[model samples]
Target: MNQRIRNCAAAAGLLFTAMTASAANYTAMLTGPKEAPPNSSTGMGAAFVKFDAASHVLEVDVAFGGLLGTTTAAHIHCCTDTPNTGTAGIATETPTFGGFPLGVTSGAYSNTYNTSLAASWNPAFLSSHGGTTAGAESAFAAGLASGAAYLNIHSSLYPTGEIRGFLTGAAPPVPEPASFAMLGLGVPAMLLVARRRRKA
Candidate 1:
């Protein structure tokens, strides 16, 4: 491509990236016996969560193993005063994902939720937050960022929770205005280099 076109394309790409960069990712390692609360039996599992601000979607994936009995239910619990401690005040919809029964002793769980879809959220969460979809999402996101969220798996043997782990990760930082300017300025520099090379 010619220098002019190349630079213009580069500039456009940078602008596009800056406009579409507001997603967050997080992970939790669930060790049943390791982090189990008092009187709970030991088990192990893992959970992953993704949140996209632009799409207003929250995705969850989980896997469990070594439970003493069949799984009764599972959920992403949150807003604890401390990380990995205290009884979870709110929980996501049970079974996390549809089509998967909570009876499996070892298996995977997956669920996709749109923050605007009130049906996908726990009723208690909505009530305690703002009784609205946006309100619940905002509160949940804040808790996640502060490490107050956690994943909890319950079983027939332990109705409360068999294993658990706290969620920990930060959202992607917003790009500074100067960063955009630097990116925009690079386009002209590239164009100048290309022009010089062609002349030589």
Candidate 2:
């Protein structure tokens, strides 16, 4: 009985570890009202971000429309003093993200950045976060997880930001087939252990 319990516990531990090792995902809904010192602009947007800690890569996708003025720049800010409010400096590429549409009222963008490279980060942000790519990655990931990071879209009319939203955790990616196999084995073992204990 004791050995059976130990086997079930080991299987459960492996299942939990496998699930937690996957990448992290976050999302935001951009709007004028979410910006600091809110504006009356009619623009709205949405951003989806994914960070893979194993590979040190970050993926970003954004879509926006209905702006009062043409777009100028877009990037991410991080480590705000408070979550869901306040403002912070840029943590991503300066001026704007690479390949971002300029002088456009509405557009869509998708890009992947290698966080292990200095070019993917703002110089000031890297310096402030311990002056290393690893340090910057750690800090930025923490900010996103804590709701202290945001995606901002600047327009000609609103230089500060026409629309912005704080990043929040999104639904996790689908588990791999191996994960399901692990679950299948672990759950039955757990159930068997429980049945034996009840019979006893």
Candidate 3:
């Protein structure tokens, strides 16, 4: 391609990136949720979460080695930063996603993560549900920027929380607030500048 064409392509690419970035997101720090024991002997597995601010949705995927005889209750509660400190919060109820309850409050959970529990990816889930929702990329950004957000797993074995983590930061690639903002503006501005330069 010609130099002029290449420059324009680059500018278009940058703009595309800006629009793709959502509000907040997160990812698993360590793969513990997978190896950790379940809240109950009946429960044993790891839970994974991912979210996208652009789509305004969270996905809660849990892989249990097995479940209690009847799968009674499950919940995603909040506790101290370090395991077993103090009860920070808990998930009272969950809205249905697809056919399963998008929640982590009862021990007998239906194991459904692909759901839009919250109409939008507000930081509220962090203060309340913790490890329950799609606390991945955008979730972390929104939660931390807003202040307060976390993750947790609960079951009949451990009513409070078997495993938990904080939504302190996002996985990566998701631009930081400042970065996102700059790109959101910078790319367009650059294109305008380029057009003017070509005209001149």
Best by lDDT: 2
Best by TM-score: 2
- Residue pairs in candidate 2 whose N, alpha carbon or C atoms collide under 3 angstroms: none
Worst 10 residues of 1 by lDDT: 179-188
| Model 2 stretches with alpha carbons more than 4 Å out | 1-20, 170-200
Model 2, residue 67: displacement in angstroms?
0.8
**How much lDDT does each candidate structure score?**
0.66, 0.81, 0.38
What TM-scores do the predictions have?
A: 0.72, 0.75, 0.40
Q: What would the C-alpha RMSD of candidate 2 be, to one decimal place?
A: 13.3
Better of 1 and 2 by TM-score: 2
**Model 1, span 95-148: residue lDDT tens:** 454554477766665667887887777889888887988888888888887888
Tell how far residue 4 is off in model 2, in angstroms: 25
Look at candidate 1 and tell me the lDDT of residue 198.
Answer: 27
Question: Between prediction 1 and prediction 2, which has the larger lDDT?
Answer: 2
State the weakest 10-residue window (summed lDDT) of model 2: 179-188
Candidate 1 residue 168 Cα shift, in angstroms, is 1.0
